[model samples]
Target: MFSMDDFYKSGEVEEDGWNLMSSGGRSNHGWRSQSSVCWVGATALCLGLLLLTVIMVAHNTSAINQWDSKYTDLIHVLTKGRDELRDERDQLKIQSSNLTQELEALRSQYNDVVDSRDKLQEDIKNLHRNRTDKSCKPGWLKFNNKCYFVSPCGTSKTWEGARKDCQQKGADLVIITTRDEMDFVKSSFAITWIGLSRHEHEDKWKWVDGTFLDGDGFWQDGEPNNSDGEEDCVELSRSATAWNDVHCNQKFSWVCED
Candidate 1:
C-alpha cells in the first residue's frame, strides 16, 4: 500500500516499475483528455437535439391551433348555411300555401263565371226565338216564337167539346211548344185543357192535332196514369203546374183561337 505522496516524492525506484508508471500515467492522461473531449461533444449534441425538439414542438403547436381555428370557422359557416336554407324552405312553403289558396279561389270564381255565361247564353237564345217569328201575335201569349190563344169561353163545355170548339175557330187545341209558353200559359190560366189526351190507352198520350206527345211538357209521373179508364183528356190544374187526366166529357173552360 504505497501512499500517494510517498509515490510522487520517492527518489529510489525499481527500473521496470518506473517505466510501467510512466507509461500508465501517459495513457491515463491521454484517456482523460479524450474523455473530456467526448463529454463536451456529447453535451453539445444533446443541447442541439433539445433546441430542435423545442422548435418542432412550437411549429406543431402553431399548426394545430391554426387547424383548430379553421375547423371552427368551417363549422360555423356550415351551420349558418343550414339555418339559411331552412329559413328559405319555410318561406317557400308559406308562399306555396298562399298560392294554393289563391288558386282555389280563382277556380271558384271561374266556375261562377262559367255558370253565368251559360245562363246568359240561354237568355239570349230565348230572346232571339221570341224576336224572329211572326206567327205569334205581337201582344198575345208568345211561346217559342209562336202565339197561343187561350180559350175565352168560360167554363161551359167538356174538354173534348172545348178543343173542337177551338179547332172551329181556325186554331187546333192549345199545343205547348216551349217551356216559356207552357210556363206563361200555366201562369195565366188557372185550369185549362191542353192539347194532350189519353183516349186510346191508359199511359199513351197524343196531342189534339193527332201528333204523339214527345216533348217534356207532359205531366210528371207519366201521362194519364189515372185509376179509372175514363180519363182521356189532360187539363192543367190551377193548384199545381202539372197535367191531370180527366174524363173527356168533363165540363171545363174552353179555349178559343184568334
Candidate 2:
C-alpha cells in the first residue's frame, strides 16, 4: 500500500502496478465500470418487463379457456333440452292421434246401438199391435186385436162422408192389411168402401193412416184401370173377384175399425 503522494512522485512504474499518476487513465476505468453497471440494470429491467408480459398472457389464456369450456357445456345442455322437448311433442301428437281413433270407434259403436234400439222398438210395437184382447165396444165385432162396425143398410155415403162419420164414432175406415183381413171383410160384407184410397195425382194407393199398400193388393182382374181417370176410391165389388176402384164421390156403405 503506497501513499498517493509516493505514487505521484514515481515517474515510471512496473507493468503489474497501477498508474495512479495519470488522471486520464483512472477516469477512463471509472467510466467503463459505470457503463457496465448501467448495462446490467437495463438488461434486468428488460427481463422483468418480458416476464410480466408472459404472466399476463398466461392469465388471459387461462380465462379464455375457462370461458370456452363453459360455452361448450351450455351448448350441450341447450341441445339436450331441445331434443327432450321434441320427443315430448312427438309423444303428445301420438297420444292425440290415438284418442281421435278411439273417439271415432266409440261414435261408430254408439250409432250401431242406436240403430239396434230403434229396430227393437219397431219390433215391439208390431208385436203389441198383433196381440189379441177383449177390449171391444158394443155392436162391434172382435177380430184378433181389433173391433169393426158395419154401416146399416141404406146408410150409404160418399167415401169422404164415410170417413168423417167413422172419425166421429172414435173409429176409422177398415184397413185390410193382411190376406186374412181382406178375406174376412169380403165374406162379411156384400159390397162396401174400404179404408184404402188415393188421389188422382198419385200413382199408388195409400191407406187412411198414410201408409201405402204393400203388394198389388186384392184388385179385381183388370180393375183399377182408372177407366174414367176419376176412380180413386177402393171398394169390395158385389160380383167381382176381390176389390175394385170406384169414384170417391159415389155413395156406398162402409166398415169402420175401432
- Candidate maximizing lDDT: 2
lDDT of model 1, residue 232: 80
The TM-score of predicted model 2 comes to 0.53
Off by over 4 Å in 2: 1-134, 200-203, 238-241
Q: Candidate 1 on 74-181: residue-level lDDT in tens?
A: 999999999999999999999999999999999999999999999999999988876675565443565555556665545457876877777776676677666555
Per-model TM values vs. the true structure: 0.42, 0.53
Instruction: List where candidate 1 sits over 4 angstroms from the true fold.
Output: 1-140, 201-203, 215-217, 220-223, 254-258
For every model shown, the clashing-pair count is 3, 0
- Per-residue lDDT of candidate 2, residues 1-258 (tens digit): 899877766634543345453666889999999999999999999999999999999999999999999999999999999999999999999999999999999999999999999999999887776555346788887776789888887789999999999999999999987868776676655788899898767888999989999988888899878898889999986566388988999998889988
